[model samples]
Target: MATDAAQPSLLLPEAGGGLLAALDIGGTKIAGALVDGGGTVRRRARRPTPAGGDTAVLGAALDVLTELTTHQEWRSVAALGIGSAGPVDIAAGTVSPVNIPAWRGFPIVERVRAHPAVAGLPVVLCGDAVAMTAAEHWIGAARGYRNALCMVVSTGVGAGLVLDNAVRSGPTGNAGHLGHITVDLLGEPCVCGSRGCVEQLASGTSITRHAVAQGWQPDEGPADAAAVAVSARRGHPVALAAFDSAARALAAGIAAVATLVEIEVAVIGGGVAEAADVLFPPLRDHLAGYATLPFAAGVRVERAALRGDAGLVGAAAIAGAATAGAR
Candidate 1:
């Protein structure tokens, strides 16, 4: 396992040699950035993710990276960090993202290291959730919290843990996969081979699906989470119920995390979180009912502070930490 001499900043002691090249890979898009110790993106690029096949997926990521290298600041890059959709095995540096079907146990680290422009740079790989945790701990909402759960509830659910002031990825770099944790023992079967996982209820895609199935029609149109949120705001019964149910499921998962790991806070982000008025109230309500133990009762829930760049920032944080530790 890799370790960093983490402080509030979570950067190396020297802190001046170079920037970090960070990649955030997901089903919809591949993003790359040049970031520094201060969580600033000096250069950035993005491309549509080609979920068609293994080569297309990797090529999209490479396209972003190649464009990033063209930036004059590329010379200052110290190391590379990838926060990917996973099932990532840090021990093996392989990834099998459920969303990216073509890449099963893909050897990402070796492939990235083989890239000509980045040949000698160290590559650190972790789940997107783990990277999100690192970002929150270093420069966002969870920065001052000694123990917290950082989650991204978007098209799918992703999360990570910060324990005793350090980002923890567990053995497989998939520790805080709150999405897959079973909330309903016998509810709908999920893509992760589980029944009633938090993702099955709380993710934006799931929320929209549930809303549509419940006959929540958007006069504006049927689209996605945004449509659901708009309908929920209008007090549509089915849409409201959909949000409430998802909130409850998320609360169950969050409570489980708090009860089991004893976190002081839960930091939430992503598309689903945008419906804060609809989501947070019921989330806290259900959370109260579930997190009954004195130890877990006081866990605070808050929105993410990093906004759109959390994943990229988190990736950069991991890269900064790993390269610093190596030095």
Candidate 2:
């Protein structure tokens, strides 16, 4: 477990009083945090997800909660929130993440609510992308945007939306699944049973695969997206082309969202966005071509202000909202 007492705080004047307990569950890690109304992380814990059966995954999540329960501030927690990798059914209180195959339609909400430490506290569940959107809208780059698209472009592409100044989670909590949107009429197939999906072209995994296929080799490390970014920085043509291809696909998808919702901005985050120098320039160039409509032409692209703590902060934001609605 790791704790950061000096973590910078986000100003949320309307956050009200009390603390929110948050859990961010993904393929790699299961993290928990006690966040104050002002968006400051007061306490935190994490556990690496084990590659085992369903019980093992649930056990790891419970362990994180147990660690958090030891904190003195746990007593003041007003609600508990969970943000898990999709596809989650908020109405059903279940999650079916692709990476965690052992947990199809897992009853996460009931299990978490059953915890002794969480006794009687309201619990909220949402897809990880939706949580990221909430975090961005609450205190990150989308703070003042009435309509925006926030994306995570890591191993895969995931996204959520902020519409009319509020996170729109739609039915089932997996509203903004931009990755599965077909961008190319004849592109690669996606694991989501779709052909020519944006994720097949724009994800970090796709970027690395494309760079490697184009004969771009790393100097002294794995042939991943970061290595490709490094090579692009050194003027490697193949690496640059790889990033440009990804940028183009992302541009297509972003333009589609802008056209459909008339979003004013698109806030991008995740591992791929870290290579901003190589990605953004080409992305902006391509976006200008696709988003040619009068309203869509004004769409702005910005990097997400929040990073590692986005999930926890976002979970807290939704939990806070749920708490307020219940009263």
lDDT by residue (52-147, candidate 1, tens digit) is 889999999899999999988888888889999888998898998867889999998888888899988889998998888888788788877888
Candidate 1 C-alpha RMSD relative to the actual structure = 3.2
Q: What is the TM-score of each predicted model, taking all chains together?
A: 0.94, 0.91
The best candidate by TM-score is 1
Tens-digit lDDT string for candidate 2 (1-327): 112223223323244557888999987789999998777788989999889999999999999999999998888788888999888999999998866888999999999988888889989999888888889887788777788899988777889998877788998999998888999988877777778998899988899999988777899878889999999999999999999999999999999999999998888888888998999999999999999999898788999888868888898878877877777
User: Listing every candidate in turn, what is its Cα RMSD in Å to the true structure after a full C-alpha superposition?
Assistant: 3.2, 5.4
Q: Which residues of candidate 2, in runs, are more than 4 Å off?
A: 1-17
lDDT of 2 at 158: 83
What C-alpha lDDT, on a 0 to 100 scale, does residue 171 get in candidate 1? 88
> Which residue pairs in candidate 1 collide?
none
